[model samples]
Target: MNKFGVLSFLMALISVIVFLILRGPNVNLLLMAIILGSLSLLGIIFAVISKRWLSGIIGVLCNSVVLVSAYFTLLAYGIAG
Candidate 1:
């Protein structure tokens, strides 16, 4: 198992929870979520290439959820296109 991949996946999950909980006019949080989601995508790619299926799958799911939620949240706030 790739520890870095696992850690990245966990961080992605935490970011999602934070994003959902802190739903307000916080542009910083939205930016942070976007950064974390991108990093998580990299983590997923690396994990899969390294044969760390569990970490890769988790990262993919968490990152997808966070990115989608972040997009809608930003749209709702009129902060994104």
Candidate 2:
């Protein structure tokens, strides 16, 4: 995985943990899931950009992240469009 991506993952994890701690267990789980899901998107992006084993792993991670992030975005956006 790229250095920046790893850092981003770690940061996301830390932020989620902190948010959960402060926002209550229920909210934390929901938020963490969303964040991880979003970070996983990096994995897919990495896969397309890189051919290394690490890149493949990151791509998977990024895909998950993207899914969750997209979910949340849709949830927030609703069907307003």
Please report, in order, the local distance difference test score of every candidate based on alpha carbons.
0.63, 0.52
What are the per-residue Cα lDDT tens digits for candidate 2 across 18-73? Answer: 44454542344445545555555544554555555664565456465556664764
Candidate 1 residue-wise lDDT at 61: 75
* TM-score of model 1 vs. true structure: 0.57
Native-referenced Cα lDDT, model 1: 0.63
Q: Cα lDDT for residue 7, model 2?
A: 55
Candidate 2 weakest lDDT stretch, 10 residues? 22-31
What is the overall TM-score of model 2 with all chains considered together? 0.35
Error of 1 at 1 (Å): 2.5
The sequence of per-residue lDDT tens digits that candidate 1 reaches over residues 1-81 is 667676666667676666666556655655655665565566556556646667677666766776676666556546553
